[model samples]
Target chain A: MSGQQSTTSTSIGSRLLDWSLRGYVVLVFVFIFAPILFSVVFSFNSARFPTIPLESFTLHWYQTIWNDPDVWTAVRNSLIVSVCTALIATLLGFCTAYTDYRYNFRFKSAYLALVLLPPTIPLIIMALAMLAWFSKIGASGQLWSIIIAHSVLTAPFAMAIIRLRLNQMDRDLESAAWNLGASEWRTMREVIVPFCKPAIVSALFLTAAVSFDEFAISWFVSGLNKTVPVLILEIVQGNIDPQVNAIGTFVFLVSMTLVIVAQIFFTFRAGKSFS
Target chain B: MARTNFSGFATTWRMPIIVWQVLFFLGPLLFMIAMSFFLVKNYRMVEAFELKNWEKMLTRGYFWDSYILTFWLASLTTAVTSLLAFPASFALAFKVSPSVRRWALFFLIIPFFTSYLVRIFSWYVILAESGVVNALLAHIGLGPYTMLNTKFGTLVGYMTLTLPLVVVLQTFALANIDRNLVQAAHNLGCSPARAIYAVIVPLAKTGLIVAALFCFILSFGDFVSPYYLGGSKPPTLPILIIDTTKSGQQWPRAAVVAVVMMLTLISIAFAALALAYRKRASR
Candidate 1:
């Protein structure tokens, strides 16, 4: 107690606490990653069931899926839906975010509240609603039905991301461009869009990732045009299938790559590369 | 000023998005409410104004059972996730350096970006009766335990969904708490454990509660987890909705359950927001 560093017992106790805490964080990370690691590992094992004492490492499942035409159809559908959803969601997001950024209007908060509300609703309810509407309108079971639902589901995320980027824009950039004799649309095309390009790209990748991995809505609305996740679900329903593991590994890689790319662009400053 | 025509163009900017959101997002939700009141005739939904779907679903014992089970399961997930996440979050908040904390945040967020269904499916393998967990248990002289196709498996799926996100949220909340208060408590002869409970926890109460609430919201609405991992032995509300719609084409009946779920979420969200922002009584 005589000096700040004089207590020997407290020093050892604190050190023990520090090491234990570090160990706990390690354990939590293991818990998070273990299932993913197992999924990846079992995807490679030649054994059909994911049992212990792993079988000889083989790519037969991957080979089998590579030859399967139905799997290819799912992969194609997933790509089309995700790509279309990404473009539409990002466009809507930028417009909404720009509106929020540039204007002050009545019911603005309510407008925003509605715009941002999709992610909060239970997905099942969202699926049910989408299914009912699509079926009623004679649009159920189409690939585009999945696309439209995913856009609705993911546009809020797009809006949120672009809005963040917009908030960081200099207040006068658009104004200065307009004052310099550019037309409103030109200023928007030249200044605002370029300024928002990185965020737009980032939003596109993010929404695409979400749409790619999305299952519940796709399952409900995609009457016959199955996305990859729906196909995986069909395979795994009521029984185990090694085909699912192979498809899952591929889907995981695709989603993770998109997300990582998005994160990279999101962290980049708009003009930093040129600068 | 160029600002003269700005407002007009602003309308041009927003109208399309507003239309999109209203048409696709808000329209379906409102339609869902309407669909709940429609009648199903001969395995087809007929648009009408009636409360039979609501009354039927509301009065049924099975529907209410699912409601209660989903409620309790979500609450259990919230409670467990909060307790389990606290220590790791606390460590990240106070024990780690800033760089380590940032890396930790990135790792936690990576899981959110991946396929949540894949994560749950992975558990299905490990928790299976003849799978890895049981295989490992045999090596330890412990009898294999049945885990899959039970509430336990559902809980595991719920954990997979909520844990990483909760840890990310709770870590942010705890890290924002002032460190000096904790130090001051320690200097006042409070033990380390007491300082955490007395000072740090009180300061982070709102964040912790909100994080737990988010966990509740995620687990409550999840469909794949309860279906695949839990084996849909007794269907959760999400699975119930699927069954109703699938078997009899009772889309109206399914809509009733959807409406109830939405109402529940909106209520819980409002309640949590109130509690979180409630002004403290004068000391």
Candidate 2:
């Protein structure tokens, strides 16, 4: 009876320890996320100073963010860049993945490596390199320069996703189409493209998210013209205002909404594909 | 004639793709390499090649110090992130219900969606002297320590950015482990801790390595965290390169530093990839 009681007490003690560890993990999660949460909550604060104690909640910062021309312009620029980057990256990624997967060619490994290199390269280095290259030919600080840089940075991710989707596809379908006297172009358009459309869409959304959130590359490449990230830097460097929190809150909402939507779409398609 | 026609069509189609790959991707790298070797006068690569830039870069005491500091920061970030992320990932993978796990993963990934700059800005509100941590510290009767403009601030900022990645990757790795192997170990009179250590860890070692490598690379290459959080004297190669570039008098020397940083990064990446590939092959 004594031994059993001791064993029971030991088990209870270990269980308590396990629970405390779990609690610690949860606390760490809060530590990681609390800043963003504070930003979101404090965006509604009436006070101008972001760090001041909370007064009555107000929507004034949101109003200010809405009325600010520079904020809107930055948002518009980010939207334009992200959309263009997504479209170009997705199209190029599709073509590359299709060509590589369909045709057995020499120098395949080298080509793949070249395509994969940019995403893994340090962003600052790539940014500096792009700056140097563009400036040498006298093309720095242009909107199109930013667009091209974003495309280059995001295309590899698109290619990787599309490649994975393509690998899962059966080559026999393409061969059968060709055997039926269908032209290669027709087969790709009708069969391969349709099969990879879901992945292509996911790639577009993912690339857009990445391009929109990108700062290091954009900071170097964006001269004169400021994106949202650049604007955030300017705000933090210059002022400690509540409007920045409001803007951050809006950005957080938009990005999270889009990611959630994309994830749902991806999950549904992935499930269907597997089923 | 028919065989020749087919081959000709294939060649024509492949040519543009190859050209795009070379011009857009390989061209910049080659240009960077060449510029690393050439002297820059008035922001243009001079006709004469010189080892002066390399020599100057090698001799700079600050350059070597920043490199060491950068590596140390990255190693610390990787260690902290892995230590924190491992248990969290294990909990999500094995302990949590599937529905809760889904929601947890979603929450973990939400920060990744926000602008990196904005997220870093948010940290200022949390770590500043008058910030959240300090406020809490004061409430508890502890003196409020300044976190911003210090190495601790930089470390915390880096941890915030990288911890999510470690958790996500480790969770994916742990989820992929064969459950039966773990169960078999437990059934064979092995304690849960012993089972995890012997069977689960060895199986998940590759994923952990990859996660650590990702954190290391990201932290090593990071300039913004230190720039924003480290106040006046940030010790990082990227910041050093930026400062050198802005000086306008040391273009060639800056290029040499950039080259060295790139080479170090590439070798590390190459080694990690080789290790990952070897592990995958063995599996």
Report the lDDT tens digits of candidate 2 across residue range A117-158.
Answer: 787677877777777777766787877778888888878788
TM-scores, all candidates, are 0.96, 0.90
Q: Write the per-residue lDDT of candidate 1 for residues B1-283, one digit (tens) a residue.
A: 5576766788887898789878888889999999999998977678899999989999999998899989988998899988998999999999899989988987888778778877778898888888998999999887689998888888889988899999998998999988888888977999888888878887888898789889989999998888887777668999999999877789999999988988898888889888877876766
Candidate of highest lDDT: 1
**All models: lDDT?**
0.88, 0.77
lDDT tens readout by residue for model 2, B9-29:
566545554565565556666
User: Candidate 1 — which pairs collide?
Assistant: A141-A223
Angstrom error at residue A62, model 1: 0.5
- Runs off by more than 4 Å, candidate 2: A1-25, A273-275, B1-18, B42-47, B232-234, B247-249, B273-283
| Candidate 1's DockQ | 0.72
Question: Which docking category, incorrect, acceptable, medium or high, applies to candidate 2?
Answer: acceptable
Compose the digit string of candidate 1's lDDT tens values, residues A1-275.
33647788888788888899899999999988888888899999998788898989989989999999999999999999999999999988988998999888899999888888898888889999999888778888999999999998899999998998888788888788878989989988998888888889989999999999999999999988999998988887756778778888898899988988887788755536322
In the predicted model 2, the residue pairs found to clash are: none
Q: Give the docking tier of candidate 1.
A: medium
